[model samples]
Target: MSKVTEVVAELVSPIVTDAGLELVDIEYVKEGRDWFLRVYIDKENGIDIEECGLISEKLSEKLDEIDPIPHNYFLEVSSPGAERPLKKDKDFERAIGKNVFIKTYEPIEGEKGFEGTLIEFNGEMIKVEVKIKTRKKIIEIPFEKVANARLAVTF
Candidate 1:
């Protein structure tokens, strides 16, 4: 995470949690001449447009007061949607038995990416059943080595 994102997360986490929402992720990126600060949020019962608007209003006020980002940026707060990234230990736990796509920081079994059913999550590691050709193989991945993970939609 960038310094600005870390700071923004720290400032926004409390506000989100107090409003019964979970902080999914934060990103500060440059696109053309504009800078964007995107905040992803979620809740157990999901979120509505009004909830997102409320968060955006409150968080925007806080960010403006802090002025942490040196560059001017547009702030966006919203739900992560159907294919939300699995970022926390609890996320992985909840994802067990569900299809997922995962990318590793380094190659494991000569592969850096895997998409399969998440069979298990034992806090420190996850086991995924991946298919190679017609055969299926189970691979163990450490939580720390996961660069990214998210729900996969299979049709």
Candidate 2:
């Protein structure tokens, strides 16, 4: 996370938590002449458009008061949706028994990416049940090796 994103997260965390939402992720990126501050939020029952609008309004007011970003940027507040990224330990824990796609920072079992069911997450390691042709195999992945992970929407 960038310094700007860290500051923005700090500013938005309380607002999100007070609203009964979880802060999924924050991004500050420049596209052409525009800078965008995107905030991803979620709730146990899922998020709706109205919730997004509400958060945008509240965060906008707060950002106006703080003015952390020097340049003009679009502030977007919305749900992480079905394929939500597994960012924190809690995210991984909540994803147990769900189908997931994970990428490792370094190769594991000669592969960096794996798609399977997240059978377990016990803080230090994740045990995934992967299908190889007709058979199922369980692979244990250390937490430190995970580069990225998200719920996999399989058709």
Candidate 3:
């Protein structure tokens, strides 16, 4: 996360929580000529357009007051979608029993990526059940080694 994202996350956390939503992630990035501040949010069943619009309105007002970002950016508030990235302990816990894709900072067990069923998360480690041809294997991944993790949709 960039400094701008960190600061924006701090500013939006309370607002998101108060609205009975979970703050999934925040991204501050430049795409082509435009800078975008994207805020991902979620709830139990799902999120709708109205919820997103409300969040955008509230966040826009707050951002206007604070004027944190020096550059003009588009503020987007929306759902994380099916392949939502898991960035927090709670996210990992919720992802148990679900299919996930995990990328490590370096190679783990001769591989840098794993896509499998997320069997467990113990705050320090994760156990994924991966299928190799006709055989099934369980891979233990240290939490610290995970560079990226997200829910995976298998077709």
Candidate 4:
């Protein structure tokens, strides 16, 4: 995460928690000629439009007060959606038994990415049941090796 994103996360976290939501992620990036600040929030049953609106309003006011960023940018607050990222320890723990897509920094079992059923996550490693043709294989991935992981919506 960048310094801007870190500051934004620190500023936005309390607002999200006070609003009874979890702070999923914070992103500050430029697209074309425009800069965008995206704040992702979530809840147990999922977040609603109204909830997002309220958070945007609150966060906007707070940002205006703090004046953290020098450049003018668009602020967006919303849910992470169906394929929410597995970022924190809680996220990984909650994702047990769900289908997930994981990208590793280095190859594991001759592969760098894995898409399978995440049957278990025991802090240090995750056990994924992957289907190879007609057979099922279980692979253990060390948590430290995972560069990115998210819930995968498979049809």
Candidate 5:
């Protein structure tokens, strides 16, 4: 996480939790000549536009009061969508029996990316049932090796 994102995440976490939402992630990036600060928020069922607007309003007020960012940037509060990122231990635990896409820092079983049903997550490792050709195989991935992971919508 970048310094700006870390600061913004700390700033918005309380607001998000108070609103009965989870703070999914924060992104502070430069797109062309503009800077964007995107706050991803969600709940069990999902998040609505009204919820996003409420978070955006509350966070905007807080940001204005603190002036955390030196320059202008867009503050967008929205949902993590269908492909929600699995960042925490609880996230991985909850992902069991669900389809997910995982990318590892180094290749495991000669593959860096795996997409399949998450069979298990024991904090130390993840077991995914993937299909290779006509055979189903269970791939064991180290939790520490995961670079990125998200819910995958399988067709």
Candidate 6:
């Protein structure tokens, strides 16, 4: 995360949590000539359009007051959608038994990525059940090595 994103996250988290929402992630990046500040939020039952609008309005007010970003940017508040990225320990824990896609910082068993059933997360480790042709294999991934993880949709 960039410094701007970190600051904006600190500023927006309280407001989102107060509204009974989980802060999924924050991204501040430049695309072409535009800078976008995207805030992803979610809840147990999921979020709706009205909730997103309310968050956008309230968060915009707060951001305007703080004036943290020096450059012109577009602020977007929305749900993380189906393939939500797992960035926190709680996210990993909640993802147990679900299908997931994970990319590690370094190769584990000659592979850098895996898509499989997230069998368990033991706080310090992540165990996934993957299939290779007709064989099923369990891969243990150290928690610290995961560069990215998200819920996966499989047919």
Residue 5 error for model 1, in Å? 1.3
What is the C-alpha lDDT profile of model 2 across 1-155, one tens digit per residue?
89999989998999999999999999899999899999999999999999899899999998999888888889999888899999898999999999999999999899999999999998999999999899999989999989999999999
Model 3 misplaced stretches (Cα beyond 4 Å): none
> Considering lDDT, which of the candidate structures 1 and 6 is the better prediction for this target?
6
TM per prediction: 0.92, 0.96, 0.96, 0.96, 0.96, 0.96
Candidate 6 all-Cα RMSD: 0.9
lDDT of 4 by residue, 1-155 (tens): 99888888888889899989999988899999999999999999998999999999988898899888999899998889889999999999999999999999999999999999999998899899999999999999999999999999999
State the weakest 10-residue window (summed lDDT) of model 5: 1-10
lDDT of each residue in 41-128, candidate 3, tens digit only: 9999999999999888888888999899888889999999999999999999999999999999999889999999999999999999
RMSD in Å for all candidates: 1.4, 1.0, 0.9, 1.0, 0.9, 0.9
Clash totals in order: 0, 0, 0, 0, 0, 0
Model 6, span 39-153: residue lDDT tens: 9999999999998898899889988999998889999999999999988989999999999999999999999999999999988899999999999999999999999999998
How many clashes would you count in candidate 1? 0
Please give the lDDT score at residue 74 for candidate 1: 89
Cα lDDT for residue 61, candidate 1 = 86
What is the model-wide C-alpha lDDT for candidate 6?
A: 0.93
| Candidate 4 vs candidate 5, TM-score winner | 5
Per-residue alpha-carbon lDDT of candidate 5 for residues 59-148, written as tens digits (9 for 90 to 100)? 999899989899999998899988999999988898999999999999998999999999999889999999899999999999999999
Q: Model 4, residue 109: displacement in angstroms?
A: 1.3
TM-score of 4: 0.96
Give Cα distance to truth, residue 7, candidate 5, Å: 1.6
Model 2 CA deviation exceeding 4 Å by range: none
Please identify which of the two predictions, 1 or 4, would achieve the higher TM-score against the true structure.
Answer: 4
